[model samples]
Target chain A: MKGFSKLLKKDLILILNNYFLYVTLFFAIFFILLVNFVIPEDTSIEQSVYVLSEYEEGNKLIDYFKEQELSIRTLDSREELMQYMVNDFNSIGFILVDNQNVEYVLQGYENEKTKNLLALNIENMFQEFTNQIDIKTTYLVENNTVQKIPFNKSIVPLFLVMEPALIGLFLIATMVFSEKEEGTIKAYAVTPGRMSSFLVSKVVLLIILGFISLFLVALTTVGTKANYLYLAAITLTGSIMGSGIGLLLSSFFDNISKSMIWIIIIAMVLSLPFASYFAPNFSPALIKSIPSYSMMFAYKEALFPTGNSSIIGNTCILTFIIGIVTLILANLNIKRSL
Target chain B: MIKVNGLYHSYSNDDNYAVKNASFQIEKGEIFGFLGPSGAGKSTAQKILTGLLIMQQGDYTIDGKFVDFKKRDYFNKIGVSFEHPNVYKKLTGLENLEFHSGMYDVKTEDPMNLLRMVGLEEAAGKKASDYSKGMLQRLVFARAMINNPEIWFLDEPTSGLDPTTASRIKDIIKRKKEDGTTVFLTTHNMYIADELCDKVAFINEGEINIIDTPKNLKLKYGKKLVTVEYYDNDRIVNNTFSIVDEAERTKLNEIINKGNIATMHSQEATLEQIFIKVTGRGLE
Candidate 1:
């Protein structure tokens, strides 16, 4: 027990003294601010003219918008409206009113939230206006609901995939390679303690570190929309697999630079496919091969609670893969010569 | 007691054997020195004895049992100080000793005493990275005593230390020997060997070139011819003389009576000079 404690204490102190906690906090706050302030602002207002149409019977879209307590103003001409749209509205674009129909125009220059909110508000007005009359205007959104994830909610997937890999690889890779370079590990090869105990101590320490990092990243970024218990389980499993991979790499490479290169390559390769916004369609075969993709998938499903079966498949695959890899690496690493 | 016979190990098939058919016995309470230059399989032999490296063709035993290199249980009976300082740089000197001490599953003594023994008591709280080369080497030597084992394997234990510190460490090793613990030391420093070892083996290129007491080696390889100076007819003269038997002694006595003999001394050799002569190579 003391042997394990000594190993854990050494690894934890190494992580703490390196200011990894500060780095994680910095990234968490930066991610939240990036989603909140930087990602949801409009850059242009050339098409901010919004129009509401009157129904055939009586009610106009403006009256319905007014009834819904929305704040919108109407102008006479497109050029005259451009000033109102630019000055009065901080949105991307607007709607144009024609006889019995309404058109929503976006100049493709506003933030994502502004574009999405304008469309949602215009549709809500039409539904409200149609309800006022005796006409039944069907809603396409009622039939098919595209998930409108808020900017705050969108960064959760990125955190889910990046946290375990970055924290695990950085901490474990540095600690193990440092030990190797210092010859402490080679010394342990002749010690009476089991090598597995050394590895297990590292895994346990890293899992705790992973959870702390997850807690920080989550409290600052994903806590509101995230399920803490589910994230805990996913992060714990992901950290275990990550520690195993780190030990495996450490077993093979004695040089710190080479181990770091391998760690960065592995982190980038795994995190690239699950980056939902940037590379969403990275081949399904590749996605299935990565361990973090399943974690990301499970976390997303757990966040949304959309009853997606991919969550079940992802969880099962993640647990099994972690189990298999941990076993294999633990077995192989103990027998490996330094 | 430690016995190693017919030990053969090669890093790879293409590489030459690091330890080939090496055999030796370390009796209890004796300081046995393995004298060899670098790349002469001294460390390899130490590693094999300490259970760090496995041998393919060896039947070695510590306290009369075959060693299982994989399990490392034999480490309980022996302690090793590597040629390189292998302490954790991130840990304090005390913490380094404490951590390694925990690896032994037994009631252990205080690590501070060991630190004090090695003159690291004041620096115990300092991180190993901040330690000088001599300080780190002392800490490494301190770590080797944490287990209080019956046998000690020290590989170039005083390599990087200053003379005073090295002698202090050697003094501690001598105290351990006084406690009846077997000490197997590997060093190229013949002066240290001559001062400490009861018996020493000179190894070169994976083979034992010579093994004997430092005094016995000097005697066996020393020059038999003695140089003598005598005053004959008031003129100084020097002559070579051999002391093989009583007849030579009589001849020398007759010459001494006939003339005044000045100075006489035996032509003895240093261990280093004898090592060079035996192996056809210098220690360097």
Candidate 2:
């Protein structure tokens, strides 16, 4: 156990000296800032126009339109106003006063929130006004189901998929291969240290670094949720599996450059296609089979209500994969002599 | 003490045996030198003894207990320094020693002390990457001594060192011997073997050509005679005489008393000449 601590200490110091920890932290933070820039926040007000005629109800509606928070501009003709709205909708939308009914004149992507806010407020005012005159007015509102998932919400899981491969796998593989080339791996073999303990230390260090990298990215690019505990579990499991992959690569490839190429290839094959930009409707079977895919899906499900399977299943599969790979690498490493 | 009997090893399934039917033993506190040219299987034998290379056939034991290569406990009792110094480039000399020391069964000495012992104390804090080959070799020597094991396995321990540093390292080996540590040294340096080894084995082509004390081999194959040189009447004269006869000694004494004797010395063959005589090939 004492020897184990010394080995762990040396491993940690090597990691620190290599600057991998700092690189991961920097990449995570910089990536967050980059993603934040790509997705701008929405704070502008909705602008639309409602037209009214000189009829009693329309006059009442005109009076009501003046009282709403909608950014309303009035014009003479609906055709001219619609043209103005199309050209400068972001700046101002027009409301026309008429007799029987009110028509909304707005640009091409305009809908209820823009069109109805003013009409509803005006109808409310006219309803109060017509109530005083013993008359009735009906206002129509189109039911629109706009899925308001946060802009970065979907990307949270995608970042989770990338975190393991981009940061964890590369770092772990590089560390192990560096040691192997330096003859430190063979040196450790002659030590009284258990291969399992040595590997566990690496995985522990990798998990901490991996989680810190992914967590910072997760927090900056997308806000954390109430169930951060669940996110952490998923992150830990993914890191373990990713680190296992790294160990397997390091154990197999003596060349660091070749190992890095393999890592990039694996990361791309597993994560890029399942990313939302490429396949929003990624097949459930494919996602379940690939390790990163399941992790990304679980993270997205946690962020939003998208998936049916629980995070527990993905976590279990990741844990199993990690265990098997780690065991194999450990066995091979222990038997590797000078 | 280390012992091996009937050791056999081959590089591959169909390859010829690198070590075959080899056996030797070294008693406690002796510097046993294995002198052989390159490709004589000296390194392979050393690796098998140190547990780096596994033996496919043999009864191998260290300190009277049979060694199971799968276990690491036997390694704690021995320290090995490779002919090629394999040190971490990015790590400082001190850091390399610290890291390797952590792998030992028993922690022994301060890394700086080991460096100082090897005349590398001044360079201890420098990165091994920036070190010269000799400095790196000294640092490896420091690493090998970090744990102070009972047995030291050195393959060409002084290969890249300067003569002074090599002598200093040899002195350290002598000190280790005085402290009752057995050393298994492998080198093609017959001079070092002649000087340091209590017993030297000349291995040629994976077989022990001769195993005996350096003095005994010299006596067995060396000329038993002396050459005398003198100047008589402003002319140089030379005479060869056998040390084996008393009459020759009397004649040399009478000549020395009657005339001038410039130089006189007995002749004994060197280990290199003796090795060439035995193996019919020069030590490169």
Candidate 3:
């Protein structure tokens, strides 16, 4: 344990002294800030409906659309509503013909699903207007309360998972390659220090950096209200897995530049988790096979606690198992190469 | 402090052995040199001894224990300075020593003192990446001594240094010898083997041809003759005389007594010549 601590300290110092680590950190933080502040939030929803009406009940329909969290565009003329619907393929346009009639306008490229949803919404609005039935009263009574999260806030967890994973991958690769190039890795082979200690030291440093980046990201984007413990757990697991991958890949290359090309390639492949993040329903089984998929799923559950511990629990277990296996493989490769 | 018998090793991809049935031993406080050109099993033997390579078919012991490359404690008693400068380039010279010293369980020597011994005290704070080849070599030497190890394994210790630095390193090896540290030096430089080694093993093609002290090997392989240069009749002339024969000695003595001799010296073969003569191949 003492030897491990000493090695950990030395490696930490080396990592701190390396300029590339700071550069990677800067880019990670820059990307987080860019996502949070610079890039535009994805406010366009597929359920956007534009209403143009001369009737006095049009305000009530617009209020219902607003309550449903749909993008509502109001215009005074039917031409303006038609123009809006034509430009936005996923949008539906409604023009009031009389107190009892309404006309629906949709683009030619709109899919069947969009047309069906638009028809259902129009029928429900006509039913409410004609019969004066209060459907929301029953919904409000049963649900009691509803929680809404902003698009920017909901996507924060994905960045938290992604940024640290990237940082760990690049940071460990850079450190390992630098040591290999200088032949200091072979020096470790002849020392009293165990190979396990060396690998653990690198992993510990990566996890520490991983947590720091996660904290800054969470604090800046999500604020103190976010669950810090869950963020830490998910980030730590992701970082360990990332470091293991980095070590395994780095063992095959003698320099950073060579390893970097593979890092980019593997990173793109491992980015299957992003599909699981943005389009959870459309995610394929291949995406779930990726190690980070479990991590990203767990992060999502942690970000918005579903009270169903089974998914998060299973994801945590799988991530850890994969982490341990990769770590063992990495250790073997490092021992052989060194 | 070290012994090996019938040592053999071969890489998996190659059919031939790298060190085939090689054998040697070293006593305490003695400098033993494995003298050979590159690819002549000098490094392979050194690697086996230093625990970098596993001993596959050999009986070997160090400090009275069976050699085991898998044991971490074995490294506590040994120090290796590779031919290449293996110090961390990003670390300051002092930091590199300190970092490596922390690996051993034993009490280490002061890193600053080791730096001073290697004539690198002033540059101890500088990163190794900015150092010259000679400076890096000296720093590697300093790092090897950080643990005050009992056995020193040096591979081409003076290969890439100026004469002054190489002499300083040689002097340090001598001092270590006087301090009762067993030294296993590997080099192709015959001058180093001839000057510092108490005994040298001439190796070629994964086998040792001979092992003996430098003086004894030279005497056994060198010609027993003396060359005399004399100023005769206002012109310089030279003649070789067999030192073993009385008539040739008398003729050489008569020329010397007549005050016609300019210079007279015995012809002695060098270690390189003896290496080629014994192994049937030049060191190169």
Candidate 4:
């Protein structure tokens, strides 16, 4: 442990002197500025639902929704709803002529799949509400409904994944290659210091870097609203996993030049979760199986939690194990190769 | 302080060995020079002795403890100066030594003192990346001594340097030997071996061909010759004659006793010549 502290001290100095400190700070500031200023606050493309009743039975159908206090806008006339939908691309209009004949009017932008999904969802709700009104049983709202995530704020999870998680893979590899190029790695082999200590120290340094980036980006973008301790835990898991993988891959090659392709390849593969993060329905079982997918969602829970905080616990536990395994493999390879 | 019995190393896990059936012993305070050209087994042997390469098919004991290279104590008592300068390039000379000083569990020499010993005190604060190749070599040499090792392994310690710096380094090695540090010196340069080694081994093609003190090898294989300088046809002429042959000895004596003789000296086989005679190959 004492030896580990000494190696950590040396590695910190190397990272500081190599200008990586400046690079990380620069990137953090850039991301903070980007999230806060460059991206629009509400890029929400979710169109509002508009409806109008023309017959007496349609009024009963409208009353059912009105009692529920949904954001379903009720207009005076079908033409009025159509005008609102035409002017506002964020709106979709519905006309309940007699409940058996319903009409949906759009601004002509939604895809066929999206239109069908929206219609199917409305039809299910229509059926449920109509059944409830016929039976006349009062329904109670659930207490655990999470708040909606704003469009710009939703992108922060991707930033965490890219900066403190994915970017760390390359950073740790760079540090390893720096030591290899300087031949200090072989110098270390002759030392009484344990190789495990040497490897763990590198991971610790990367975690420190990761924490700094996380704090700067989070505070500037999300302010003091996040679960900081949970954020820190997720970041810890991410850095270990990133640095461990970087070390493992680097152990097989002699220098960064030979390993750069594979490094980029792994990073790219790990980044496949961003697809699911942006479009949740796009998630296939394969992408969901990736650790980064869980890490991305876990960071979301930490940053802007929507009550499913258990994801953070599960992701941290699983990634921590995987991280440790990679670190062990990296240690063995370095012992054999270096 | 160091003993190896029939060490064998095969990188491919097959019968083709980089070092085969090598055995040697170095007593406390004696300098054992391992002499061989490139691709010979000197490096493989030195690496094994220094705990860089694991002992595959042999027995090794350092300071009377059977060597376990995985043990921290194996490195605690030994130091290695590589042929290549392998120090932290971003660190200053002093910082490099100081960092290496921290790796050992034993008491270490002052980093500044090691720098002074290596004549790098003036440039101690300069980053090693900015240092010359010789300066970097000196820094690595200084680092190897930071622990005041009981056994020191030096490979081509003075391969590149001016005569003055090389002599200073050689003097340090001599002082350390006097202080009872066992030295395993590997180099292709015969001059260093001829000057420093108490006993030297000549190895080639993964095997040790000969091991003996330089003086004994000279006596055993050297041809005693006398180079005669004398006046011939109104100009100074030079000729070499074997003193052991009766006829050549008479001629040499005749030249020596003559008034025309200007200068004469005895000659013996050099270490390189003896190496060629034993291994049938030259040091590259």
Candidate 5:
């Protein structure tokens, strides 16, 4: 254990002395800030609805659309509404015929499904307007505070997961290649230091750096809402898994540049969770097969739990198992390469 | 302090043996030189003895204990300086020594003292990457002595250094020998072997051709005669006389008495010549 600590200290010093660690940290913070501030957040599905009428009923209809969180744009005439609809593909035009009826106009290029959905919603609004019935009903609103997370905050875990995992892979590759190029790895073979200690030290350093990166991203984006303990656990698991992958791939190459191609390939595999995040409905079982998928999912649940303990528990278990298997494989490969 | 009997090693199952039927022994405190050109099993043998390579077939013991290369304890009493500069480039010289010294349980000499011994005390705080080639070699030598091991395995310890630094390294090796450290010096430079080794072995093609003291090998293979150069007319003339012949000895004396001798030298073979004669190959 003492030897392991010494090795870890030496590696940490190496990492801190090099600019790679600082550059990675800078990029992590920059990305988090960019995601939070630079990119506009889409809070809700807001579509502009143009109301072409000057009547009191038309005003009521505009109020109703506004209540539904739609942006209401009032036009002066039918010709203006048609011109606006032709020019703006994303906006729907509402032509009020009388107090009892209305016409919904969509652009020619708009999808049929979106056009139908818009027509149906307008029909319901006209029904509520003519009948003067309070049709607005709230369900499951008591003690079920469904906090609407911003797009930036919702995707923070994706970046956090990717940063540590990819950095872990890059770190191990550079470390192994550096020692191999210098012939210091062979020097260690002649010393009293065990291969296990050397490998463990590298993994531990990755875990530490992984935790720091996770903390920084979480703090900057999610703030106190993120479950720190769960974030740390998943980060450690991802780091171990990443280090294992890096070590395994680095053994095949004699230098870091050669190993970078494999690192990128493995990174693409690990980044499958991002695809699953952005397109949840399109997720395949293969994406879930990726180790980072479980970590990312578990992290998301920890940030916003829906009371599904079993899924999180299973993800944690699966991640832990994968981490262990990869770690063992990495140790074996490192020993053999040395 | 070291012994090997019929040691053999092959890098792979289908490859030829890198060290074939190689065997030798060294007593305590003796600087035993394994002299051979590159790819002649000198490094393979040193690697086996230093616990870097495991012997496939044979028995070897160091300090009366059989070593298993896979065991961590096998390196407790072994020190090795490889032919290349293997120190961590990012680490200061002091830190490199301290880190490696922490790996062993033995009491290590102060890192600063080791640097001082190598005339690198002022550069102890500099990163090894910034060191010159000679300075890096000195640092490697200092690192090898950190544990003060019973057996020292050095490979081409002075390959990339000025003569002054090389002499300093040789002196340190001699001092280690005086301190009872068995030095297993491996180099293709026969001059270094002749100058420092108590016993030297000539190896080529994964086999040892001869093992004896440098002086004994030279005497056994060299011509037992002296050559005399004198000023004859306007040019120099040379004469050879056998040291063991009575009339030849008188002729040498007469040349000296004539007092016009420009140069005279005994025709003793150098270790390089002796290596060529024994192995039918040049050291280079």
Candidate 6:
């Protein structure tokens, strides 16, 4: 522990020199504006349903769709429906050749399950001569009628997952890569400094930075509505885990450029749960298995208490265990290789 | 004081070794030069001694005790100046030294004093990243002595430095040696080894070929000779004569007596020549 404080101080200076604080502040401001102004207060991923009809009853279907408040667009012909569907990855189209026959035009990437669901929904919608989606909808937070987080505020969980919880993955890698490039790791090797102290300093610096980012974005977006104490515990554990992964990754590769492929691959894989965050019903077992999946929901629970305090405690415990394991593995790898 | 016996190391972790049965000793204040070309395992031996590489098969001891690099106190007693300059570039030269000084538990030399010794007093406030290569090399040399180590490991300490700066670094090393610091200097530069090392070890292909003082090695492997340069009929003529051979010694004496002799000097085989003579290969 003799040089641990100096090592931590050195890491802090290096990170700041890399403009990490400025970049983090920029992200904080951007997220604040996004939650407060850009993303609407009452928004959802309600896919637009475009309708194309050759029959006269199509005009009646539009009115029916409008009355039900289904997000629908009317196309003049089948060509237009195909054009729109081809261009819009998120939208589905219904082409009605006659009153009895309706074909679904989908963007090619939709899987079999989604195509079948869309077919069934189309069938159920137009069984009574309707042209588009006719599923009964309920607005949970419209006009604050239900006890629910607003759509814009609900995005806080995903932001927390991406920023404080996982930013350390790349930041720590960058920090370690910088030291390697400078050849200071070799200098560090000869000193009386402990490897555990050196590794711990990096993790500690990231945890501190994570807290700063968390407070900046969370306070600006969620404010007192969130349980700050719980957020701190969860973010601390998440940051430790992120830094551990970064350290383990850095141990194998000499520099960031050499390790960049894996860095991006891991980053993209870890961010996969963000899709599930916005699309709750889209959770497959794979998405749910990601730690961030539970981390996102944990952030949500901390922001908006649903009497599920167990979520916060469970995530913190699980994350702490993962953080400790990865740190141990990283330490061993670094000692053996670096 | 240090002793290394039967040290062996291999990168492949197999029969092929980088260093084999390397052995040497340096008494207190003695400068031991590990001289070899690239891939000759001089670096591997130095790294093992410095604890950057673990001691795999060796009896490497300091004083009367065995060195355990894992023990923190072992590092406190030693310092290393790497071949390539490696300092915290974001920090000022002074700050870099200060940070390194803090790593040791022992009383350390003042950062400013060490910098001053290396003629980097003015650049003390400049970030290491902004330093030129020679300036960075000087800073690394300064940082190494910050701990006031008893055992110092210096790898090509003046490799990239200009003559004046390299001289300054050499002067500092001599001063450290004078202060009773045992120095392990690793280099392929034979002139440096000849000028500074009290004893030199010539290694090649992972095997140590010979170890002795530069004078003794030169005497043992090289013929005694003297080079004579003289002005004759408005032209300069150079001739080398062996001092040991009766006929060549008489010729050398005649050249010395000749008043027109512009320069007359005794010459011995350089460490580089002796290395090649012993190892049957050039250092480069």
Error of 4 at B206 (Å): 1.1
Better lDDT candidate (1, 5): 5
Candidate 6 lDDT score at position B219: 81
Candidate 2 stretches greater than 4 Å from native? A41-79, A82-148, A221-226, A257-261, A276-278, A284-287, A301-309, A333-338, B233-266
**Global CA lDDT computed for model 1:** 0.74
For each candidate, the alpha-carbon lDDT, in order, equals 0.74, 0.74, 0.82, 0.86, 0.82, 0.84
Which sequence of candidate numbers ranks them by DockQ, best first? Answer: 3, 5, 1, 4, 6, 2
TM-scores, chain B, all models? 0.86, 0.93, 0.95, 0.93, 0.94, 0.93
How good is chain A of candidate 3, measured by TM-score? 0.76
DockQ-based class of model 2: acceptable
Rate residue A62 of model 2 by lDDT.
52
lDDT of 2 at A212: 86
Q: Interface RMSD values for the candidates, listed in order?
A: 1.9, 2.3, 1.3, 1.3, 1.3, 1.4
Best by TM-score: 5
lDDT of 3 by residue, A1-338 (tens): 76787788778778777865576578567866776887656676456678887788777767766776767788989878877777877676788766777787866676899778878977886676558776543352554343565677677766766765665787788888878888898787788988778887888888888777777767777677666777777777777788888888887777888777799988887776787687779778887887777777677667666554576667666766767788888887775555
lDDT of 6 by residue, B1-284 (tens): 68889999988888899999998889999999999998899888988887777777989887879988878888888899988888888888998887887788889999999888888899999888899998998888888888888999999998988998888888888988999999999999998999999999999999988889998988887767778889878899999887779998887677667778988777777888888888888878
lDDT of each residue in B1-284, candidate 3, tens digit only = 68889999897735589988988889999999999988999998988887667677888987677877777888898899889999888789998998888899999999999999999999999998899999999898888888887889999999889999899999999999999999999999999999999999999999988999999998999999999999989999999999889999898888988999888888999999999898888887
Q: Against the true structure, what is model 5's DockQ?
A: 0.67
List pairs with backbone clashes in candidate 2: A51-A96, A52-A96, A52-A97, A52-A98, A53-A97, A53-A98, A53-A99, A54-A98
Give the candidate order by descending lDDT: 4, 6, 5, 3, 1, 2
lDDT of 1 by residue, A187-214 (tens): 7776787778778877787678667667
Model 4, A306-326: lDDT tens per residue? 777899999998878888999
Query: Relative to the unseen true structure, what is the C-alpha lDDT of residue B176 in candidate 1, on a scale of 0 to 100?
Result: 94
TM-score of each: 0.82, 0.80, 0.89, 0.86, 0.91, 0.83
Error of 6 at B187 (Å): 0.6
Candidate 1 lDDT, tens digit per residue, B123-237? 9999899999989888888888888878888888888888888889989989999999899999999888988999999988888877899999988989776777888888888
Give me the candidate number with maximum lDDT.
4
